[model samples]
Target: MSVVKMKLNGKAVSGDVEARTLLVDFIRQYQGMTGTHVGCDTSQCGACVVHVNGKAIKSCTTLAVACEGAEVTTVEGLAKGGDLHAMQAAFKEHHGLQCGFCTPGMIMSAIDIVKRNGKNVSEDVIRRELSGNICRCTGYHNIVKAVQAGAANM
Candidate 1:
């Protein structure tokens, strides 16, 4: 087992995990944070995207030990005192989700995109930024709208 110490959702966490444990498994199984879903084990699907040190990363592709002393933020961390994050609120207001399987990762990625960019971001820019995240339900029409709206508020 390897020892990992990291800041998770504004809380300091330390644990011992098997060497092969993925970051997604560690967040869900060990930390009891299921917001980071494991849609595709191959890392092709961005369903397990999360913020590591303020950057997006595929939790399923990252080793738990690799996150030692890192700052990790999952979808669950997006809310504060029951109030949704601006991106989540914008997604809901713009109908950016369907079956909701990809919503978490989409929001995570979108938040990072807007944070890296800004409110004046363009549709084509959002589409290019969201290229890594796949949404089978919305067809990206409303998804783009959601990102733009979310960006405006951010």
Candidate 2:
């Protein structure tokens, strides 16, 4: 077994895991950070997205060992001082979610989108950048709107 150490949601955490263990499993199972969901183990769905070293990545397909000493941010990490992150607030206000199965990853990816594309991200860019993330709920009208609104507030 390989011992992997990483900062998870601003907390230092370590685990003894097999090299074949996926980061999603390490987060949810080992670290008990269940906010990062696993919709598709094949990486087809972006439901397992999380921030690793400030970039969004599919944790389901990412190796835990590869994330050793990395900074990992799950959905649970967004809020600070009991206040929801701007993106999360936007999602709630804009009604971006339905069943909420994909909300965590969607929010995570949205934050990354805002960070990479800047605060003034357009609707077209938001839609295109979110191509990897699928929402089987709404037509994504609200999700897009929330992303754009959240981008401005971020």
Candidate 3:
């Protein structure tokens, strides 16, 4: 077992985790942060995406030991002072999700995309970048729209 210490959301956390434990499992099981979901263990599905030191990453593919001393931000961290982030608001405004299984990761990735891609996000580009994330509900059209809208507001 390895003891990993990291900042989860905005709080300090430390735990004794097996070396093979995935960051997603560590976050959910030890930290009780439920917003990070594991859709596929292979990391092809970006449903388990979270921010590690300000960059979006697939937590399912990331080992907990690798994240020691890092800063991890799950979907639960996006809200500040009970206020939703702009991307979160846009997701809700555009009805970008149904069943809501993928919303957390989608929102995290969308915010990252907008931060890097800016407001001129094309639908095709959004779809291309979001290829790794699977959404069974909206068929991606609304998700793209939501990202575009969110990008404009960011």
lDDT of 3 at 115: 74
lDDT by residue for model 3 over 1-154, one digit each (tens)? 9799999998999999999999999999998889899897898878999999999899999999999899999899988888888889899999999989998999999988887787888888898899889998778988888899988987
Worst ten in a row by lDDT for model 3: 114-123
In model 2, the worst 10-residue window by lDDT is 36-45
TM-score of each: 0.97, 0.98, 0.96
Best by TM-score: 2
Task: Rank candidates, TM-score, best first.
Answer: 2, 1, 3
Question: Which sequence of candidate numbers ranks them by lDDT, best first?
Answer: 2, 1, 3
- Candidate 1, which ten residues in sequence have the lowest lDDT sum? 129-138
The regions of model 3 sitting more than 4 angstroms off are none
Against the true structure, what is every candidate's RMSD? 0.9, 0.7, 1.0
Q: Please give the distance, in angstroms, between residue 37's alpha carbon in candidate 1 and its true position after superposition.
A: 0.9
Looking at model 1, the pairs that clash are none
> Per-residue lDDT for 1-154 in model 2, tens only?
9899999999999999999999999999998878989897888779999999999999988999999999999999999989999999999999999999889989999999999889999999999999989889797999999999999999
CA lDDT of each candidate?
Answer: 0.91, 0.94, 0.90
Checking candidate 3 for backbone clashes, the offending pairs are none
